[model samples]
Target: MPLFEDLPRDIQLAAMENAARTTLANRYGITPGAFTLQQYEDNCVYRIETDTGPHTVRMSVRDGRPPHHQASELAWLDSLARAHTVTAPRPLTTTDGTFITETIVEGLGPSTVAIFEWVPGHAEPPFREPGIAEGMGTVTAQLHHHAQTTALPDNFARPTWDAADILDRGYALTHPDHPLLGANGAAVLRAVAERIHARGPIPERDRGLIHGDLHRENMLLTPNGSIAVIDFDDCGLGAYTLDIATVLSSIHRLCRNDSEAYADFAHRFLTAYEKIRPLPESMDRFEDFLLLRDAFIVNFVTSSTNTEVATWGPRRVAGLIAQMQAHLAGDTYPGTLTS
Candidate 1:
């Protein structure tokens, strides 16, 4: 039999869910009904149903992200909600008025748990819609503007998404010697990492709190037609271009069949973004940003405990290597910046 971490992701999630059932009543003072597991990646997200309305409970399954980090994420979300910068899911406090509740899961160790008010919107809508890219750009710009002007709590802390952290460190986390990444694939990754480092430090204006994972799935289309960004689980400090690269890479993957649409999507996003704030001059080297994002994806897939992700790791790594090799050859990959 496989170990807990090696077990199928659904089994692991079910075990964790069973252990966490008491949390809803004891921490958030709600009688849980139909608590369905929504996501089981670095964290476990449960879509909890109640008489009043649905809520979201996120449990950090790893030890690397401490309670303060979770609190800091909530702090930024709260700031965005208060400033009306964007429609972000707001965190709900426990019965004791605290942001996070600590609990021990069966296989996973001590975990940080937080409940959030359900964000209203359609999930995973088509990104190629006429206005979808524009909405993403607008909401992203709004969030960045708020981050630049507003002051986060002094204790606010999240992982930095710099070159070393984003590329080299992530690759290392995925295990440099992993069989999926043969000598050629490993060399391509190293070359991309070197290019990222050679780009030098980010200019002060370009560096700030960024939603580290603002891909298409993370942006929700609200009923009023506004874009609502969710899943702040990866929000952190980094160059604002990181967020741009995230969405653009997603567009590249999703729109691979139509380069024309990809170009239009990139154009619409940047145009709408500039309407609020000028893009960072560093965007001249946007390929590095895209490659950086690709590297992160490789690490995420390779290191995931989820059996589904594990199964996809080899193919995903191969695609990422091809993209990296394309860049190294001075040619454009599907995700290379079009506009």
Candidate 2:
């Protein structure tokens, strides 16, 4: 596990060469220059400057995560861009029009890489800015609205937000005598399972294409206060309300110290979104959705190698378990799902 910065120059060159060939950069005089790595849990994103400006080359090590996945993702993104749903990174194609290049890193496993035209903007902290909620809400509504009519390819895997899936994932966290498994973990798993059972099965009619992950960190902001959404890696067919639930859960986490601000942000987001898409009568199920969303985060952080979560997982899990207990004990938050 060599850190991106620690990789020898030769390996970096190989990655750069692979990117150039795949993106058809030879045709546009685009040669890789200095590179910086932005590594996430499942992939490594290299920001490579070329003759044509900056482009991103994303490499995923886990099998089934690249080449085909990249191609499918770019197709969906291209559709969204054409429909003006939101600003997404445009995939750069080679002279042959292929979307990915296969490459091998010395210490890391084999990877599939793709080049994307860089999207310029900065990410603003949503909890710190009240106005951002409206923009986010509006963008989310528009995204869902557009996805409804967009034709998906045969291989597109729709996201599953079913309660059964959530519970099964949580249960998988404790396995084969892993040291992290304990009474505390067991309790959390049980709580999540009980919540899922109480919620019943996810309604079949509510399924649609959703961004899957809509936290504030995934949005970019321009100087004029306009926003652009990115990272459709999790985009798939699922409960549309689950997207709203993800945003609300993120708001809760962001505004933990300022309850009033959290309420304000939630209000603004819902207000703007409803003006466009108008929540369904079944939106009353949001509380259940919130519970499952929080559980998913808990399981993901505990199971992942993400540094931020690695440092913060224990405390966050405790807080979330407490919140779940409170909800189970009849504590209620405002905002009716029916509204």
Candidate 3:
């Protein structure tokens, strides 16, 4: 079955109209002609040409599960725009001003659709330049600062980061017969969970609204040398340190080959961030945060029963489990930024 055919008809229509309005007749003064869909590792993005130029429309899928927090996600985006924090895709509204249109497709479950003005740019490749690192750091700091003040909706689900939450999910992923399950996975997960629990909850001073996922891929570099951050789907209220950890982990993943170059980049990024929002006094726990981040990814990837996940999840989970064991056993963790 074709991917989109599973989306409800109304949602499909809304998506098409959103593509038309945002890219063409609304501000660009031209109509869109033919549209083509680009499937990424995570979402289905469509590119259409308008009289003004070409624009892209993104639609997120749940893989096999139901839509995850569609209403709350849109609400958070609206709140961010209202607060005037940073430039985010304002939900393209209909004549009636509703953010999403729902529809029921035959084979697929209910789906909600929304649109936004496409921001154009390319992802900075790994180890490009130290200047890029500074740019990323400055923007991330600004984003965290803005997020700190925004009031999120009541139902905004926080990122699953609590020690118990991590352990519970970790066990679920490592259940016997699961391909990703390993002898050391459960033990490593327990150790991390216990360490976090013993440290106690993060004090309110270190907790705030954060872009739970702030990797380089989520940022776009425009022709004018400006950077635009996109994809607030993972935005939530969490430890500010976790946000920093996410960025650091992503940099390490992308620049694994050129440690010296990425180390320079990481230093520049962190320096810029410290200038804006200084790292918490508890920043000494950053190594723990990094371990938590890696373990969380391992659990998520392994728990997913989706075929797309099965191919790579097991191996990656095993690798992370081994690394965590080594760390716990006094081996220095490998990465650009060490404790």
Candidate 4:
């Protein structure tokens, strides 16, 4: 089935900022916040500048996730912040006094729009400073611990990250016969997924709400040397290792050309995280989770028509496929964790 975000670039951009700001102005009877496009990956992010203070307005094409699910995710973030689990973005109400509002576009169907008080600090690169990796580890442990003990809301519901074909089937750019994946390539993808699952079902303690996409850009490093996590839009029920795998896959893809750089980052991040909460023995299954995470990225890029991505798609896709092969073969990685 064609995904909801299948709208062409111009149409998608047209549904954002300018229209959203005008709608807000008409509803609230006040000046709307000035909006500048921030990012355009899974969602259309805008930096909202107002005289009062800066905020953010995020619009996601309802690719099966509706306003309610987005609201549930926001509610969870609010709770996490209140309980000191981690510094998180707080939901901003629209003029209708709701955290999430639905906007029906001509052909794209209904999209979810929400606002958040922007976090002040920047998300530093993982290798930017000495303790950056350690900080990521420390904060991620705190989030996992929170997911373990907190009482979630009644309406809390989101799909598990591991459900087969969830991303591949839903992505508009991918299908069983896509040229990039080739013909037998479809079979290869499923076989790897099955092999990963055969390792056995995850134990109860190892599963819970996860920030499904915590790669570097999704986080911010505040001036006080603390972490401010963002983009919980992808949070859902899954193995805690799913979260680790997401970050690990990021390190591998980013430093694919430099093994030494990968080692330095993997060590500091793993060492600091283990210091807070010892690496779960369940982590022996980490490579499996890594493959799953990398597959998610590969699916997104190949399926996307983003101009910049399309420009480099051929090279990037090949590199990702190679990384996946080496990862599954246990070849491209260094020590599992650095001391």
Order by TM-score, highest first = 1, 4, 2, 3
Clashing pairs in 1: none
Per-residue lDDT over 5-87 for candidate 4, one digit per residue giving the tens place of the 0 to 100 score: 56667766876655567655665333655667787765778887776677787776436467678888988887886897688
Query: Mind giving the per-residue lDDT tens digits that candidate 1 earns over 20-71?
Result: 6778778878887888877776788898888779888898875457888888
Candidate 2 Cα misplacement greater than 4 A, ranges: 1-29, 63-67, 125-130, 170-178, 306-309, 333-339
Q: Candidate 3 versus the native: TM-score? A: 0.79
Write one digit per residue (lDDT tens) for candidate 2, span 72-165: 7777777877886577778776556766666555455466767788777786444466568888888888887877767788886444556666
Candidate 4 residue 16 Cα shift, in angstroms, is 1.9
Clashes of each: 0, 5, 1, 0
Which candidate should be chosen as best, given TM-score against the real structure?
Answer: 1
Q: Residue 225 in candidate 2 has what lDDT? A: 75
> What lDDT score goes with residue 1 in model 2?
68
Alpha-carbon shift of residue 125 in model 1 (angstroms) = 2.6
TM-score of 2: 0.82
Superposed model 1: Cα runs more than 4 Å off: 6-11
Give the Å error, residue 273, model 3: 0.8
Q: How much lDDT does candidate 3 score? A: 0.64
Of 1 and 4, the candidate ahead on lDDT is 1
Q: Pick the candidate with the highest lDDT.
A: 1
Model 3 lDDT-worst window of ten: 59-68
| 185-296: candidate 3 lDDT, tens digit per residue | 6766777677767887777788777676776677777666666677766665567787777777888877678888667877888898888888765566777777767866
